[model samples]
Target: MDDLMKQLHAVLAVDKIDHNTVVKSVERNPYRRLLQEVLLERKDIIRSRMNLVALYETEEPSSEIEEILAQFENPTFPLEEINTEKEVEWQPLERKYLDGVSKIKEETTMKQTQLEKDLAKSLAHSEEVLKKHRDFRPVDDRDFSNVKQSITKHFEQAKTNLRGDAATKILVLRREIEQQGRKRRNFDKNTTDTLQNWFHDHRTNPYPSDQEKAELAKQCNIKISQVNNWFGNQRIRSKQQAIRMEEEEQKRLAALAAEESEAMQTALAAASTVATSSNLAAASLMTLPLVNPTMHAMVLPGMPQNLLAGTAGFLPQTNYFPTAGQMALADNGNGQPFYTDFENFGLATQPDSEQFNNYLG
Candidate 1:
């Protein structure tokens, strides 16, 4: 029994050593593991391919697949024997295809390079344009705005001042025109003489009619309004002169009446004395010589006929009465005299008949 047990132990120990050696050799061998992995991957690929074929076979086949199968079954050309030399030979079509591909790649590379250069140039040009704009641009926009506002304000003020000045000038010119209008126009000497003559001719009705005024204005070379004014003034002045003359005549008559009354009283006393002392017949004859009836008949021969006729009842003595023309001439060429020196001239109780006739005519 001991020999048999020893032999069994040796055999089991040898078998264990051989198993460990085989495991170690397998772990160290690179080709052996690669072979095993390749075999396992190949088995999995075959299983996936069989599953796909089964799935495709279960469904209906497409026309494209049937056409492909027909192409394989009835090829136009027989299978050619591949010559190793012909497989490596350069064909014209293959060379052309290769050249075309190479040319297209070269063109694409050139275009890409040109595009990069153009992009760089565009970027540079854009930067330059931006710089120039910045250089020419206004530094402060607010300053420009303020300047524009100031200019507008100045123009507005200038326009306002100009308008105001124009208005003021217009007002000043209008005032000057009004002042010129207010000034009176001086008439000529001829106009004055014409007006005076007409006034004397129409003394009875001094107010002229419209037609008469027009005629006078035409003759005098003056306006009708001026003629009317002249007539009005002449009428007023002549009336004042008439009043003055009447007052002077009244004073002279009163003085003459007082003198006549004194002379009568003296004569009466003398006559009474003469009658008592001397003969009554001589006293009566002396009184008759004192009262001469022909004394009033005395007149100057050189007196104007018109003056003589007008003074027939008032002042019959031409020596005591001057002609009306002389009285009119005494007035310095204005219209009429305001007062007459009747007392100094011994003109008493005489109406200016010649002047009245001339004025009426």
Candidate 2:
């Protein structure tokens, strides 16, 4: 990536000089031409975004380019021999060549900064839609799309700048975005593949067998408990979901059955409107408002079922099965008939005959 960027910058710088030749006399040129302007603008945006990285290149590389430009002033090496390290390294020639290169590099860097500022200002003034698109770009490329558009416009407006180093550098930025995107895709694919294989192996009876567990520990480079706990949690979550589904199904079925049974019972009750003694007594007992059935069922330990069955025959027709309130007040069973000494026990008084009849029915 770095090598490609250097090559790209070198191309842009060369084209910028050619562009300068077309538009202005070397003696009176006030500003750079199209390629120069574009390359300068790109450099500024890159400098700001990669400021930390730029410190090394901007300072060190500029110094080196300046040293090279100094050699141009004194012909320390013949023009044809400028590319050779041998003559260029000798005392007088070396210093001159170094200075010449340094100046050239500095001039190019300055040109880059100017172009960046121009691009940045244009983009900052552009439409909100363009601004939004720029914001979604990566940290390095946040200003790229807008910058590219501005460079294109500048070139069309200024013919001399049309075919220079700036165009080449812009292409470099695009290649950078592509390369980064490809790397990111590969990383995501690898992560997904690892996760998929892990889950596939664990899907059935997800709890790991001892051998599988050891292998997983080695593969993940983790403790056995970590793998064990993760599988345990996943299994528990799956079980809870299954149980909730089953409960929902059971409740649905029970609701359906209850609705049908209620309809049948409503019909049966209508047919038995003429209530009999047993029916009336049972209805009376059922109607009595009690706190809890377990307490009611405990009232007489070892109490014969036949006693409850026989109570219907003993109840007087006029009384409609003695009110439970009356029975409660009857006695506290210390050799007393429950009915005769009702006032002595701490119990409620009996209901009226009308309430007793309603309860019986």
Candidate 3:
């Protein structure tokens, strides 16, 4: 039936308690009761190394304890604020923690008041006695011990936050390093273009000096090794290309010369044929009168029609006839050596040797 109360785990000294006057603190602030469960001695956490700020900050806010958190968020009263040196037990609480889950009724009762008095006396004497004999701090004064512990804890927290920030920064730097590695392996676009332009510009002597290579690497944001490799490969490729082009050019010239030679041989053969045909035609024309004035052509009866007839369409040789026949044995179809009247088939006059030679020429 007393289950509405939620536990409070102290984040810092005075995170739970209100004042050094235990009677007033327990009576007025029932929810601010301190317990031993959160102390280093009671904690089961590893090494008992506590980080209170981290613990409290990470915990989900309890709607049941909204009133307590609100005061913690924005305090108005002195008691609403975290306990300071003014509180009798602030020193002991600053060094440790507080855990409590007492029912609201129990916290408000006289029994809780007596317990708070006893707790305030333990580890911390009566505040009146401290001020009278032990030189207790003034109400407005700060405890150097509390201040030192706070600075130390905050510095540690800041260190942890800074470490997280450092982790993120390292990841970004790692990505950039990877990007640079890729650029080194596969040359960047700007560097490629720059190198190509340089190569073409200095085609006569594409080599670069050490200083020039250094400048190129600086401008391209790349490594010297990459630049060196590019030039070496380009030179080799250019040489191979030049050799291939020369071979191709030679092949092209040889093909042209071969074509020209073949054409000349064809022309010479044509001219030879024409000259032979012209000489045969000339011989045929010279003998035509001896054969017959009216005849255009004569193919011998026993000869094949395939005789070289391309001499002015047909040729007649005067050697076919016999000379000096008076009374010819004239069998017309019996292989006869016949003689004809001077107007018809007659003895052929032999051409003069000098005239024949000159005519043939």
Best by lDDT: 1
Give the Å shift of residue 276 in candidate 1.
6.9
lDDT of 2 at 61: 27
Each prediction's TM-score versus the true structure? 0.28, 0.21, 0.27
Q: What is the lDDT of candidate 1?
A: 0.44
In model 2, what lDDT does residue 115 have?
66
How does candidate 2 fare on TM-score? 0.21
Measured by TM-score, the strongest candidate is 1
Candidate 1 per-residue lDDT over residues 1-361, each given as its tens digit: 3453343234325323343443344344456444344334334333433443444444343344334323223422111232224432424433443344344435544654665565455445434433332232222444334333433333333333333433343334334433433336678888888888878787777788899999999998988888888887888888999999999999999999677556545555653443344222223222322222211122111323333332222322222233443342222124433222232223334436466334223
Estimate every model's Cα lDDT from 0 to 1: 0.44, 0.42, 0.43
Q: Rank the candidates by TM-score, best first.
A: 1, 3, 2
Better of 1 and 3 by lDDT: 1
Worst 10 residues of 1 by lDDT: 292-301
- lDDT of each residue in 17-128, candidate 3, tens digit only: 3334433332344332232222232232211124544544643433434444332234223221533434554433322211111222233334435544554443243233
